[model samples]
Target: MNTKIDFSHLGDRVVYVKPVAVADLPQEVQAQAEGLDELFAVHNADGVQLALVADRRMAFLLARQHDMSPMTVH
Candidate 1:
């Protein structure tokens, strides 16, 4: 049985980012995040904000971030 459901039609707010470990990320995202980690030192700031790509569209803006890369993970 295919458990995958198409939620694309839902409003943009439907997809939300919950707190999860970097290891728990989907393999593809985990890999990409790993690579990004090597190149960027993710940081947290009170006012700094960045736009992240989501579902072929710029869907979300995040604040108070931290590094998820291997170098920073430790």
Candidate 2:
């Protein structure tokens, strides 16, 4: 039942990925979300949000597309 994760020591070769609920999005984002209830987010080494993606694969792909290395935390 524990779903928490510790990413404080995550390596530089990886981009942190997490899920975000549609309701938590900003008004502009929520309005453009259409019917999606959730989205995945990609973050860089400094914990900066890089992209909001529709799925996990897209997150990984985005990192690669941006020339950054992606490592799976799980």
Candidate 3:
């Protein structure tokens, strides 16, 4: 599931990986999450969400792939 993504626009920054309940997400987002109760969110230093992934490992891998440092929020 490693789709090519362009991350050159986002300068190098520390990103945070946090867990989020699927039920708490918007209806459209939750609808796409089949059989998933939880997901991981990658946020920038400004607290802006950059991506939502299926697991913590994916979240970290995504950030690293984009040249960003990843840290666990909890």
Backbone-clash count (model 1): 0
Stretches off by above 4 angstroms in model 2 are 1-11, 72-74
Best by TM-score: 3
Can you give the lDDT of residue 43 in candidate 1? Answer: 28
Q: Can you list the residue pairs that collide in candidate 2?
A: none
Tens digits of per-residue lDDT, candidate 2, 1-74, equal 98997655644656877888989999999887888998888887788888898888898888888776766544
Error of 1 at 65 (Å): 17
Q: Which residue pairs show backbone clashes in model 3?
A: none
Q: Compose the digit string of candidate 3's lDDT tens values, residues 24-62.
A: 999999999998999999998889999999999999999
lDDT of each: 0.33, 0.79, 0.91
Q: How far is candidate 3 from the true structure (C-alpha RMSD, Å)?
A: 9.7
Order of candidate numbers by lDDT, starting with the best = 3, 2, 1
- Which residue pairs come into collision in candidate 1? none
Worst 10 residues of 1 by lDDT: 64-73
User: Ranking by TM-score, best first?
Assistant: 3, 2, 1
